[model samples]
Target: MSTESSAATTLTTADLTLVRALQREPRATWTRVGAVVGTDATTAARRWERLHKAGLAWLTAYVTPPTWTVGYVDLACTPDRLLAVGEEVCRWPPVFSVERTTSDHQLFLGIAARCYHAMDTLVTKRLGVIPGVRSVRMAVATHIHREGGGWTVGPDQHEPSRTSLPLPQFWQDGSVRTIVDALGTDGRLSSAELARRCGVGESVVRRVLARLLRNGELAFRCDLAHVAAGWPVIAGYRLDVPADVLDRVAAAVAALPETRLSAAVVGRGNLVVSTWLRNPADTTGYEARLLRTAPGVRVLDRAVTLTMPKRMGRLLDQAGRAVGYQQILPAGGHPVPGG
Candidate 1:
């Protein structure tokens, strides 16, 4: 398996199996993976390194939403000073993800301290103070649901119709192992391919999938990459408003055009709103409008992003598995299905 070079790199079927197995139980030992994939432990470890180096896969521990304050900022830099500005923003202590998008604005952000104060401190004390920061629009995370990214696309598999939706752990019993893994990476897999991956016949897979859909173990028609619809404001905002209207304000902003991911997360202000503007020029006006839309609103902080080093809910790494340069670039729609 190769993660370093997407081109001229190849992965074995066993590597594919290993990828699926680890996604389920991050702690699955090499001995365990070897047994399931029919390889020795040493080979498994070496293969793990190969996968890591090639950037094909990663084993990660996620930051549960409760603990970290997720902030989004859109920053407009001097066109000539853009690269220097990106370098400076990337230096901020709290930023875990930074990336330059198609827009002139750079996306700079991170998952940080839970106290809303920390967000203000970062904005006023850290990010806002950066050279050429211009102005920023900030948003805090309230509740986050990063949709299952793995969905296969091809002849045999059609997106499985989960009859009943089940809890995340519903598959702890193994009735839908393949189904879950497939949807986890790519949510639009065909039933025929799903049955092949799960080692079951197509008919059985369909029946079980229908039940899972009905139970809620599976979600239908959820595309977290809301930017897919193609509007680009990258609106990030922070506001101090009555706590009671928190939900309503967030909902209203979310209802606007080009809302990809929105949250009422922890931050200095009571609410942090994330949305796309479709026009960076409208950035300030957009924030002012949010304040106007809701009564008694005060703008506390804001910044536009320069770059998104990591997006959605990607795991950066942990103590042992956290390799510095290793990143599982979300698949740009690969064959087996996975985010």
Candidate 2:
């Protein structure tokens, strides 16, 4: 067996049960988590702390798309400086996820911005001018059928219910921003801790958090190293579809068990999908399954992720574990130093 698979086996079934319990309720109390996992609160908390400290699992939050403009960028960089270019871009707050992929466009980025104009400026003026960047192709997500935040740790979990809440004026409140930044780094922070960080009363923190969650303004997710989770391969597919069937195609693709992200975009390819697989060979079978399920989808391009340096502002190591954290504010709101 490969080293990754061997490392994966080290996670006991009990450890995964704890992860799944959190996947269902990201901010549940240790008492609650222990109840669901059939262990005591102290043991559950201790085990989670160990996994988190090792960068094997984590919890984080993000402002869901449609609240801000969501876009993807495919960048072709000089082969010699490809890793350098990815490192530079990954530090920016707007670029939430950066992947080194097996394609002519060596880097793929997921970006969020306040508006299309801001996204354009960030790309054309900021990203496009990077020293080693040879070319840029940006696609605006017209619909977010599924996103990484919606994915769960194991099989048999239903998709989280989604509620479309209007953007509230208080979204820009200082306390709210503080809460979001703190939770984005550690979603499991207690209300008292979050209140302390936001310099507000616990009651105030509770009220605001309830409002945000009830309104669907903030999203929390439980994430773990994919390799340790035993799904070692990530494949992305670009698809062309007639506009008439775009939504239908997106729904069909997003419903697949392996899908991590499925979105309709306004670009060369109208549909883009990313999926987890047991092995590289699964990519072929996945495409064939998509063809049978979503006949309207015509696969245009594909790329397999080689390394994910960052995801949703959390820096990851080669094994896809969260090694460091960066706050991802609304795209363009936080300025990068020296930009």
Candidate 3:
């Protein structure tokens, strides 16, 4: 484990290099990463281990259910039960993210479930029953133009490989679910280790992984604590964009330096965007520049995230350091009970 003093230090150039390498290849071998980053395999592995221990960096896998629907929900909560409600909602199996924001709605949730019926049940039956619940407004996502997996902390040292591979038609089998579960917490697991966990051969594991990556059925995200990374302010926005230029507007927003997430959903505010700002006051300037770049884009509502208790399955401290992880498996995929 890294000492508190060492963990408190700012990230070094070598640390950034290693993180960039992992961003390109989330599951690459240490030897391969070392070759690219100009270091020995042992040093590369040790540096990554340190980063993970400090809660500054981590890798997580996301599998999109084939027949599932995705939704972004806003909940209005009574002031007294806000904290309790947020904590409980984060434990739901289908919920991927939960945030406390400064807006009319106190909480924001991202959910994924098997189908429309499943999503309805989750919102109406499960989430609605929570004690502090007031009102729920959900926006079903139509297309995900950009996700956090594509966001990077630094520029790439080398161009990523563009090699194309054949994709599988069906990936909802038990073996695939096993692989996803094993890799969810640790995306750097070796093929042999994954095979052992899945009770399959190494070659079979490799094949399934390749298909998942090629077909866009899975996304691997390299997460960092924003405040620790020197970017303290996290802001979210919903944009009302012209229908014809929606895709163009989303692309422009994703290209911004501060963008952490950008997507198009079905709601009054169709485009949802999240950005990290160097300072809280920079929000106005950033929004101004966005309007200049995308002429017809109108900002509907903006909220600054006051506290994020959980993100991408990892529970975070007040200072944004990862303290532990909570595994939320897909409800309809495989029944791995949450701990």
Cα displacement (Å) at residue 185, model 1: 3.0
Where does candidate 2 stray beyond 4 Å? 1-10, 161-163, 334-339
Estimate, for each residue in 13-128, the C-alpha lDDT of model 1 and write its tens digit: 67666655554434456788778768897897788767665344554322233334556565667677667776665444355455565544555454354367766776777667
The window of 10 residues in a row where model 3 has the poorest summed lDDT is 156-165
Alpha-carbon shift of residue 64 in model 1 (angstroms): 14
Better of 1 and 3 by lDDT: 3
- Candidate of highest lDDT: 2
Output the better candidate (1/2) by lDDT. Answer: 2
TM-score of model 2 vs. true structure: 0.93
TM-score, cand. 3:
0.88
lDDT of 2 by residue, 220-306 (tens): 878888877777799999999888888877888888888989888999699989999989999999999887765666788899999
**Candidate 2, pairs of clashing residues:** none
Full ranking by TM-score? 2, 3, 1
Candidates in order have lDDT scores of: 0.49, 0.82, 0.75
Q: What is the lDDT of residue 43 in candidate 1?
A: 90
